[model samples]
Target: MTQAAAYSAARRKLHWGWITPPVLFAAIIAGATIGETRIPVATVLQVLGNNLLGTDYAVGRIDAGIVWDYRVSRAVVAACCGAGLALSGVVLQALLRNALADPYLLGISAGASTGAVAVTVAGVGAGVISLSVGAFAGATLSFLLVAALARAAGGGMGVRGAGVIVLAGIAGSQLFNALTAFVIAKSANAEQARGIMFWLMGNLSGVRWDDVWLAVPAAALGLGACLWHVRSLDAFTFGAGSAASLGVPVRRVQIVLIGLAALVTAAMVSMVGSIGFVGLVVPHAMRFVVGVRHARLVPASALAGAVFLIVSDILSRVLVPGQVLPIGVITALVGAPAFALILVRGRAR
Candidate 1:
């Protein structure tokens, strides 16, 4: 390719890379904020402008009640949670050097669930912060154990060496799940048991603004780390041998990136109870749209992930006559088919 043409093409990709995320983020935020008393587009904008200006005046006020309670909080939680999980997935895919790698493919979700269940069942823990802390701890510890075992099993340190750890995570996750069930069942407080159940199903019913801060730093950190390492991630695409020959420090980068992804996953799962597929499905889909460059892919995945979850949460909130389906259900619905397609396509290739 000619230098000028290549330069122009690269510039175009860069521009779209930045533009797509905020656009997708904005649309999802607006759509999810629209519920029964659907706010007109113009009104939503006015409220947005007023808030950005730190004013009491809103752009448009529809039904004051819906705006105050259900829609706004739900939209915020969905955006944060979606971005967190999606970014985690992108980093993880690079770490594993596997197109199929997902955020929860490690035992993080299971361990996080165990920690969250303990908090809900025990009833003496600090609300969301305590739960987030416990979950992150559990997730990190589980991955550490699995990765350590994989290193030993592989006779070296690298993604291949860590492959066995994936299996270990699966086993560990099953044990954690069983333990979570037992812990909740034995809580012995009826209200605590009910809370535990609701948490397990995953709902945004009571999501407060406060619960969001826990995820923000983790998501930003993980995505930032991945973006910084985009070249290294791309090098690994050709396989570990190629990456190492290219000075990728394949093992060290793998460890750091995977760790970051795990932290992001732990943070989100703790708050939202394991929303699925944004990580697995969104990144792969974005790959088709934007190509395999991690720089573009990471942000695109973040944006797509946000849009996917916000819409899914909207569906979960409004799907039934009088009840909301857990957000996890909608994600699972979208993710399962997409995941199956990825697997099938991989086989075809």
Candidate 2:
């Protein structure tokens, strides 16, 4: 490459990297501003400054509570969920070489739903286990089941095994989903059942500072892990054998990255319920914008995903008068059409 061309490329990367954080910040502020009652942008900024920088802007207590205590935390958690899930999708798609690969398709979300219901409705730990812990355990179980099934079907982490892995994931998801239904039906009362159903469909209504503590760290860790293995992820874009030939420890990378994906997916689902299509849609959409390179793709997807979910959450709050829809509903309503467009565009290419 010519020196000028190299400089131009570096400039482009620098531009994107600089632009993404501001875009994400704007989206979060927008999320904080638009809610059941509209708060002014100035107030939102003041609330942030007061909370983060100890600057008092003479904001009203109610407005401060709404911004810092409620909307800010919700937006932060949504961003974390979006980043984590999108990173999971990126890893799965690159490693499996399957465009449809995502946490939902791999049974992670289903297992989380089952686990959450088990704790909430069935009293799995008799009030000892939190919903997030239960969900994580269930997610881990589902991944193990899918892995075992794939192995039994003569499939391993290779290009040839992608189909088997997907199939096993489908089976595992169905099994856990059925288990979830059974638990709800047998153990839950009418009110409990209603609450579980709402949560399963993705409810961010209860998100608070506590969730932010869990979610932000999980997302940061997932992003760090992905960045650490960027080269291996790029290599796996070709195939497992190709990655191996390139001195990427194929088995170890597969286990570590895939495990990280599962853990991140579970953590998000546990916190936010089973919001879908962020994973399936964001990575592919980002690939179109950022190119196939993981170096660009990973952070790009995370930023896009965070913005996407914040917007989706904003829509969920405002799309209907006096009612907040489940966030999963909003995501699917948007994601399904976007996904179809992606498919049509891919076919055209």
Candidate 3:
């Protein structure tokens, strides 16, 4: 690369680095500001200042509680879920060499959903296992199942069986989804069923500080894993064989990255339920903006996903005056159309 081009790239990166933090912060504050009860942006900021900066802002106790404990926590969790899922999508797509590869498409979400349902309805853990644990276990199991099926179908390391894996993933997703539904049908009462169903669609209504702790670490771990393997991911762009020829540790890379994808996806799905398309949409969108380099694409996708989900959460709260829609519904409403456009555009090319 020419010095001039390198200098320009550095400048661009610095500019975005300066801009993205404030944009993301503003979106989080916006999420806190607009809700069932409209709060001023000023009040939201004051609440944040009091809680985060220990400033005495004289904010009303009720308003402060609402902003700090409820809205802020929810928005932050949404951001974490968004970032984590998006990173997973980026990793899966790069490693698998498939544009359609994502946690949902790979059956991770379905497996998590099944695990969560099993715990909630079937009482599998019988008060010993948390929903997140169950979900993670299910996600790991499902991934193993899908991997085995793909391998059985003649798909192995590299891009040789990329299409086969996707098909296996679809089959795995259907099977797990059916299991979830069966559990709900057999074990849940009316109220339990309704709550489970809503949660299945994705709910952030009960998110709090505890969830924030889980979400932040989960997202951070995913980002760490992705950033750690950025070069290997770049090598993976051509094909697994190409990556191997370039001295990438093909099997180790696949195991570590894909395993982290499943782990992170399961964690987020456990907390937020099956919010779809984030892993599928955000990375592709970022690629258009940041180009295909994983160094840029990974972080860019994480930021965009965070803001996208925060905005979606806000819309869920205010879209109906008396009723709050599930966050998953809002995501699907936006994502499905966006995905179709991606498909149409891809086809046109």
Candidate 4:
């Protein structure tokens, strides 16, 4: 290639890299400002400035509270959840060497749901542990169980291992989902069951700052861990033997990255229920733009996922005026079709 042409390509790549972060930030701000009450973008910024920068601003108390306390928090949580789930999806797909692997597909979300339902509906460990804690515990346990089953089934870093893991995940998801149903059916009254069902469908309606605090750091840690092992992930693409020969400590890296993915999935699922598609679709969609390298794919998928979910959350709120639709329903409506398309495109390739 000519030097000028190469330079232009480099410039384009640099431009995209620089522009994505700001664009995602703008999307989050837009999401925060464009909710039911319709806070202006400027007002949202001013409210955030007042709190974060100690800047004097004259936004109304209600508007300020709505922006700072509720809308912004919800937007942040949505971004965190989206990024975390997308990162998890990328890691799982890379680690397992499978395009179809995702946190939900691996039963983590169902496990977290079972845990949350046990606390919220069945009143198990309610006083001793919060709902989020219970959900994380459930998710961790589910992941452990799946890991054990997969290992026992001779699952490792290849197609055979990927198949075993998928099968185990399907089994685990079904088992936990049934347990969740049973808990709700036996323990919850009619009204409580209705509310539990809505939560299970993934409502982010009443998100507060606490939710944001919980989700954001967990996502950050998970993403950081994934990025730290990007080189190993790339090596694993060839095969476990190749990766091991390259000094990647293949088994340890797999366990750590998968664990991180599961942890992030649990954190998000505990807060938002099992909102699907962000993890599965975002990584696949970003791959077309950022290429297959985990180093680029991880961050690109994270940002794209955040933008997608924030937009989805906005649509969920505005689609029915005052009524809020469960975010999971919107994701499923979008993800199922996108997943089909990915499969078709994969087949074509």
**lDDT for each residue of candidate 4 in 83-144, tens digit (9 for 90 to 100):** 99999999888877887789888888999999988987778984888887888888888888
Candidate lDDT scores, in order, read 0.72, 0.90, 0.91, 0.86
lDDT of 1 by residue, 1-349 (tens): 5999679758866886678767865765575355544666655554655556666653334443455445665677777778778887777776666565675666677777887667756554656557777787777876776666666677243556456756766677777778888887777477777766666666777776676676567767876787788889888777778899998898898888877777777778777786667787888888878888877787778777877888887787677756778888888888899879877886797
| Clashes within 3 Å, all models in order | 2, 0, 0, 0
RMSD (CA, Å), candidate 3 to true, equals: 2.0
Give Cα distance to truth, residue 167, candidate 3, Å: 1.6
User: What is residue 209's positional error in candidate 3, in angstroms?
Assistant: 0.7
Query: Estimated TM-score per prediction?
Result: 0.85, 0.94, 0.94, 0.91
Residue 241 CA displacement from its true place in model 1, Å: 3.7
Residue pairs clashing in model 1 are 46-59, 47-59
- In the predicted model 4, the residue pairs found to clash are none
C-alpha positional error of residue 277 in candidate 4 after TM-score superposition, expressed in Å = 1.3
Higher-TM-score candidate of 2 and 4: 2
Candidate 2: where are CA atoms >4 Å away?
A: 1-17, 156-160
The C-alpha stretches of model 4 lying farther than 4 A from their native spots are: 1-17, 151-160
Better of 2 and 3 by lDDT: 3
Expressed as tens digits, the lDDT of each residue in 311-333 for candidate 3 is 99999999999898999999999
Per-residue lDDT, model 4, residue 83, is 92
